[model samples]
Target: MIYRIAMHNLSNPSDAEDIVQEVSLALLTKCPDDKDDIAVKHWLIRVTINKCKSFHRQFWQRKRESIDDYLHLEAPHQRGVMDEVLELPKKERNIIYLYYYERYSIRDIAEILHINANTVSSHLQRARKKLKSILTEGGTYHD
Candidate 1:
């Protein structure tokens, strides 16, 4: 799950692996105080996202091509859809991943992302509309 989220965010297998390793180190060093399983999951997610965002700020990120050379979905069309998803703005992309792939409710997504439930809902709605329009029209995806 962590690797998938990292892959979704970074779009590069190497970078995603780096993120997973960094998150693992964090887990070893700074484990969350809460013993609740849900809280730990959320903490790891938060840590992973923070690491990905920090990675984006590095100067090298601008020079690297955003490509997933390692991921080959079972269906050819899944790759196309994933490419479109990768093109989405980061916030909407994360929201979409959480809502759909993670099977998270809007309220749960809101809590996980530390945003208002309405904001999460709005993001989800807009992301859906954008995906629908882009996908239904053709394979063309615009930034």
Candidate 2:
């Protein structure tokens, strides 16, 4: 789960691997043994998200480069949709990835992301509209 969240945020497998390692180390050193499994998972996810955000901030401060160059390599045909998703703003992209790929409910996503449920729904709606427009413009949207 940590790796998936890192991949969705960072787009690079190597960066995602680094995030997973960092999260694992943090968990090992900081996590309380008394916490339940679910609580531990949530703590891990929160840490991973924070790490990804910090990484992005640091990278932007240093390089000001676009994330496109770091995107995961996929087949040519599938790249279009993936690219469209990647082109979304960070909040929308994270919402879409959590709602769809991670199969998380809006309330769950809100809790995980530390946002309101309505905010999550709004982001999801806007992201879907943006994706639809992009896909339709590319003549790839069927419905």
Candidate whose TM-score is highest: 1
Give lDDT tens digits, candidate 1, residues 1-143: 78988887888888888899999999889985755888888888878988999998888764445464568678777778888898788888888888766778888888888999999888878888879854446443221
Candidate 2, TM-score vs. the true structure? 0.74
lDDT of 2 by residue, 1-143 (tens): 88878866777767788889999999999888998987787788778888989987664434333445555456554556666877788788877777766677888888988999999989988998988754355454211
The CA lDDT of each predicted structure is 0.81, 0.76
lDDT of 1: 0.81
Q: What would the TM-scores of all predictions be?
A: 0.85, 0.74
Give every collision pair in model 2.
none
Q: Candidate 2: how large is its RMSD?
A: 4.7
